[model samples]
Target: MRAVETGKKPVLSAEIFVIPIEADRFLVYAPLRRAAFVGNAGAVNFLADLREGRGDSGAGHDGEMIEFLRRLEIVDAGPETPPLAVFSDDPNPVSVTLFLTTACNLRCAYCYAAAGEGAARHMPPELARRGVDFVVGNALARGEDHFEINFHGGGEPTRNWPTLTKTLAHARRLADAHELRLTAYLATNAVLSAKRLDWVVANLHGASVSCDGPPEVHDANRVTPGGKGSSASVIRTLRRFDAEDFPYGIRMTVTADAIPRLADSVEYLCANFRPGQIQAEPAYPIGRGAGAASAETAAFVAAFREAQGRARRHGRELTFSGARVGTLTNHFCAATQDLFALTPDGSVSSCYEVFEESSPRAKIFLYGASAGAGGGWRFDREKLAFLRRQSVDRRAHCAGCFARWSCGGDCYHKALTVHDDGEFAGTDRCDIIRELTRDQILARIADSGGVFWHEPPERIAAEGCACVSCGDEGRIMTGRGVKKPDRGCV
Candidate 1:
């Protein structure tokens, strides 16, 4: 904002967007201020005139429109954009994700890594020990009490049973030796044998299972080596998990063929199994699913919304990765957050999608490898810096997007594939993000008495949002008054 005098025409403070809904009605939104309202053409014109510095635009209705805009902090809001999260250059991480192997029992139609197609690469237990040692050393050096080890990779982690258990035992020994806590998580297909399932239930702190709904729906894609649907085994795993009361989340991948059954799938899962959270995503057109029909379409969005409704009735939540509306962020996932993921080859990968050397974007995401000796790792600082620079605020394509902050520029890997390493012009996922985000905004309004939706600046700041003005850390300048978040607010 330019310097304002005692009596000057006010300019638009926040980044405001006017989305046309129908013939005359418009959705006036200020993403930075977290304010949204439905308005007519007259209201839109009033805002335009104010932004263009016209004279006496808010003169009608006793200047009530001006007062209303001011209350919403869209007219004179100052510096309410959430702070862009920063990453460290030193890259000392306290968590490590081990991609156990490039082997799987199932040949999912959309297997990103094309697992089991090529010669399988199993992670040697010694490599796992080295990775764990590095993170545990970092945790101890940083005075952190706990370190995390996540089981994730291009293939089924349980396929490498020996290394998987050995890695956990090694991490436990280190945790005991250093008197630190060990947190472990697994992301698996859940097509496990009874012995392995029992071991997982007794061992891991939490797990994320991949199950795409009922038998027919799941069978369409997630099939075994013998071309049989793996849903029975998956359901058995879920039943075991429920019986043991294990902490877990269900991740469902919806292909184009399965989009119509999305709602039914969610209903089945909710009715039968108990998962702490249910995350749904359209199958990416990569690996074996490449050149296939695109699933990131309007129909998918409708199906997701319907599925969400079904889950809500069952007291469950269905989520899309890029459509988060309430959270404010600049990076979508740990891909941009320097995730310490060790591949089967002991090479470092920041993205779960780029776990294999054969990946098209492997050169871009695989940033480092082991230092060859004891416990140290090597990284390319230039690559790390490039990855760290990928924030939503830095993207030109996402500048005008209302969901930029919430979606955090969407998935970086997906962006690369969509644009072919060129400028991020956006992909079909952008529409899905916008539509879902708009729905979330409307839901917030209806939930909060159904007229307009506005979040207090201090409340946002209280949640560690560095959106203050006047260069003061203790005070947040808003249209209301100088407000401060209460101490120790979560």
Candidate 2:
């Protein structure tokens, strides 16, 4: 590392990023090392204390921070450390997602797939087998011990049970042939038959069910094509998972209307379903939700805190998007990970939201296709290059942001749709990203015995806070932020 010099002043490491959480309290994080520290008002006097060669306790918490800075090499560090390397262009991806079909039983108000009305599309058995061959070949070439075959779609994967079952079997055969371990994942709306649920529990490693929340909210949005509420069916699916103690989670979509009920939604899900985890995210204004209203920022944050509290009390975890403190990521999701999502017609899309080839976004994101040549699939290297360049380090607007690596310019599809320039800048959710990330940073600090000096033992009730919709139970902020499931959120 080369020292970042400035007129003889001791240089702070460029790798060390800071965010002020409250009066006299700050969170200092090192993305490259995935480490963090907390400091108070006196911490600001680091240079002065160091200049005087004093490590006196009279300097208080600032003096303690000074010691940590020296130990962590964040201060007294002459040179700026380089950021982590960019994602690989020639990737040997170990996971492949088969968009089983673009068909759904429910017509969610904000369905990005606009499911239930799309051209009925299903993945051919040939294409599904080819997708498995492609990913398994790459994993073997890379000498990876294991790989994953995931089911997802612009609509619902369970809708195409025959394709899903056949694909999983084919993938397992490929893994066995290649001497590799294999796992399966499903992203479903969970309104399928009881027999299907039995198959899912027996065959898949884990599943993520797309349910809004309590019946009232879930019924309001996740309805059948015939305009009937499908919440009861989804509830039954959740019950099946609970009965088996299966590893599964609920993915709750928070639309503008759902914002007020955010905490209530959490409580209801936790009380009724008791899922292992609850992954909540605000609705993006894309596809069907493009014409819908958005949740207010402050309200969303407050409700998230409340919901987070409720989730913890029930021994469950609640997650938000674009905010994971422990990860030092270069990309927010799998779009840039060389991962493949095979659409119905044998085309490969980088994002789940851009499955249809006719979509304008597909020009930039649809990176591969299988045309039945040699009875298999193939990737386009040229298109792959474009996806590789979508990392956070390559973005101009994300430059110098403290949460750059943690947030990693989340969701390229959303970025492209909002900015129309394929950059994750100026999005409506930026505030939520920062706030939720800061909460994690502070929590990590507190966990390490550093003070969250400004935080109340219990969350203060913000008058008129939408979190009140869940009840007046005070909350304490921390792990409510979004984290990628072990199987991923897709």
Candidate 3:
């Protein structure tokens, strides 16, 4: 409620985050108002006095600093950022993400789902048909005219080839029959046979393929059933994709072992291949990677920064899920946004990591199930409501964070793991998120003529010449990029 006064003492209004760059210089930020600038310690103390109700009203040096802040809207502006909107009604999602199977062709060391470890479970074609029917029906009823079907990985989606191909054919027929537009994307490890690669190129709209850079780095982790490197197959897939001019993105996972090579990997990918987007994330300990040394460290952040610079040189962006700045949102990804992802058995999961019925966190994420043959779906309203409530605004730990709106509270799935299903506490990813987001902010300022930066359209935030490679179609990025299923998951 504080504001600048004509004769009375001036007051600080917006919440400020002072990030130091030098002994005296700092990045003064007002997140809600979307204002920022670099200032000296004297400028900092001037604001501090105002915050403490002792701001010098005398028209002198402190007065000039006050005027500067006022111009930035940091002296009198109210919080323009609103609370995250929550959906209370029954969920009627237009997008359907199908976790096609749990039968990956390759064994990734940091595989979050630990696919190929289990006996393998393939989604029934009937379940796919039913999901397609439901979504198509919803689209028609809602007058959407278009709907999306995304194939994501609980395992390699392509491993369930018969069902994978057949489902898309069925969806196409439905699209044709109703004269409705249908779009589909897949997430894969990219170790493909010629026929499968050809099928993917021909049938699907796009894909997010997993590739951890050079043969040595990629092969060190991503191997096959008989302990052979899968990099050759992956490279062949990329080559074919390049030849076909296929629309796809490359997802690179940096393990502790891969951290040193991150910049090199990004350099290699940018030099050798042509991918529209390249996203890299530190390997979190989960699945086969559980208890493995975490790549989520300061070293990874330094490496990502270097890799981002390399990617920019190639006219491509290098990104991480949890460090997007310039984005404004409440939830990190689709998990909180009613992402209707179907598990292999036709069960529903909001999170990609919690794919099976037996997953420890199933009760929290598995909110619905197939109501059987003729019946459609049965969702737990309570669970859906709980999920919707997981936005950044409700998170206390994020309340004071300047990057909260941009990072969108990181990843809920990861948060749960870190907090052991208890109250939300910040994670190690917080440091990484803040550092990268800071780099992005500085880059944005530098890009928009560096003295200062306020707000711009999301496209401007996400695109433009910023060195940060953390934008997702102009949407918010957070731990895991907490986004739609079209992006690759490993």
Q: Best lDDT goes to which candidate?
A: 1
lDDT of 3 at 8: 54
Candidate 3 Cα misplacement greater than 4 A, ranges: 1-13, 53-64, 457-490
Tens-place lDDT digits, model 3, residues 1-490: 2333466555677878889988899998877556788889888887777778776554444555667777777876654544354566666766677888999888888888888986899998889888888888777878777777778777988889888888999999999999988777877888887988888898887878788899999999999978899989889999998999988888888899899999999999999999888888888799889999988899999999899999999898887777656556676767787767889987888887877887778999999998887768999999999988888889998988878876777788889999998888799989998999888878877876888877743543443211112222221122122233222232
Q: Model 1, range 1-490, lDDT digits (tens) per residue?
A: 2223335455568778888879998888877788888899998987887777673433333256666787889876666656587766656777787889999999998887789887999999999999889888888888888787778758999899999999999999999999988878888898998999889999998788888999999998999988999999999999999999998888888888999999999999999999888878888898889988989999999999999999999999887877666666686666666777888998897777888777788888888899997569999888888987888899998988988877778788888988889999999989998999888888877786887898876766654322211100011111111222211000
Put the candidates in lDDT order, highest first: 1, 3, 2
Q: Give the better candidate number (1 or 2) by lDDT.
A: 1
TM-score of each: 0.90, 0.84, 0.90
After superposing all C-alphas onto the true structure, candidate 3 shows an RMSD in angstroms of: 4.4
Which portions of model 2 show Cα errors greater than 4 Å? 1-11, 33-42, 45-65, 77-91, 422-424, 452-484, 487-490
- In candidate 3, which residue pairs clash? 318-469, 319-469, 321-478, 322-478, 322-479, 333-482
| Per-candidate local distance difference test | 0.79, 0.68, 0.77
Q: Residue 186 in model 1: shift from native, Å? A: 0.6
Which one is best on TM-score? Answer: 3
Give the winner by lDDT: 1 or 3.
Answer: 1
lDDT score, candidate 2: 0.68
